[model samples]
Target: MSTKRYCLTCDLKDDEALIAEYKEYHKSVWPEIITSIKEAGIVDMQIYLSGNRMFMIMECDETFDPVKKAEMDANNPKVQEWEQLMWKYQQGLPWAKPGEKWIEMEKVFQL
Candidate 1:
């Protein structure tokens, strides 16, 4: 099986305490969220933090469709809850649309 990779970027609230809290929450992500992610066809995912900046690496099979996942998440109460909770720490890039989050990064170099 082959997989595709995507990188996304977002910014945190830039408060030390809030950043610590955010990392703690990631230490044990809820089971429901894990299941939802797998169901979305994501093969592997990881997030990294640098100061107030955040980057996510998502690897998925051809079955993954981000648009479809967004639709599914919209109807899932657990997802809604998770998103609302994360909003306390996450912020969209300045160039992002009003309601957009996790702006996709362009792959300028690959080898």
Candidate 2:
């Protein structure tokens, strides 16, 4: 079976202390967040950071559906709480829709 890959980008507040706190929180993410991701059909996910910018890579199975995932997240209190907590460190991209956190990246090249 083939896996679908998605790349997204977001930014964190430019303050150093806040960035550090953000990293620390990630070191031990809440269990509910992990479960939610797995249930959403994300096989693997990774985040990379540079200064205040962040890049995320997600590999998902065929069952993954962004709209369905969003609906699921909205209904899960733990997920909502986690998202709210994350917003403290996250900032939407300039062109992102209102309330959008991670902006999906366009694929321009592949080998």
Candidate 3:
């Protein structure tokens, strides 16, 4: 079993509205997003949120490449649409550039 780890973060400006929207979208994430993840060899994924901060953890197989996954996402029309829609309820870190929503975190510890 591959034990790779990756992380991503986004913000929730308006707590109630953001939470509701997040929950609703997660109830059925876009099919293309799921397909893209699986295609990239992502084996397991989880997301956690506290107040306005969101974190995503992912485990990927040998074939996984974050850069490639990002390229795929950029090229997929459905994924683009989904991302655009999602941005309406999400915010990026202060350091993130204008069009960027999720920012990767460096892993500092593992046990």
Candidate 4:
């Protein structure tokens, strides 16, 4: 398995609401969304949050491409829906571009 790490950040304000929404929605992530993720070659995925920052860790096959995964997400209706709903509880950093809910982080170290 190939392991990779990515990062994203949201706002700490309304963290309770954000966590609640995350828990609630994850209880039933749409089938298509799950399929899309798996199909994109993601073997395992996890997100960790502290303050308002989120760190995403993913393990995937050699075929995984972050660019392709993003394209698939953009074209998937379920993903769009989920993102829209999530935005209700989350806030983006001031530097985030318009319409961007999550800002990807730079990878600086790996062990």
Q: Which stretches of candidate 1 lie over 4 Å from their true place?
A: none
lDDT, model 2, position 58: 99
The model with the greatest lDDT is 2
Please, what is the TM-score per model? Answer: 0.97, 0.97, 0.89, 0.75
Give Cα distance to truth, residue 108, candidate 2, Å. 1.2
lDDT agreement of model 1 with the native? 0.93
List, in order, the clash count of every candidate structure. 0, 0, 0, 0
Per-residue lDDT tens digits of candidate 3, residues 18-80?
678887899899888899889988998888988878899988999998889889989999988
* Better-scoring candidate (lDDT), 2 or 4: 2
Instruction: Report the lDDT tens digits of candidate 1 across residue range 23-61.
Output: 999999988999999999998999999999999999999
lDDT of 2 by residue, 41-90 (tens): 99999999999999999999999999999999999999999999999999
- Model 4, 43-107: lDDT tens per residue? 88777777656666667788889889889899988888877777776766789888776677787
Clashes of 2: 0
- What ordering of candidates by lDDT runs from best to worst? 2, 1, 3, 4
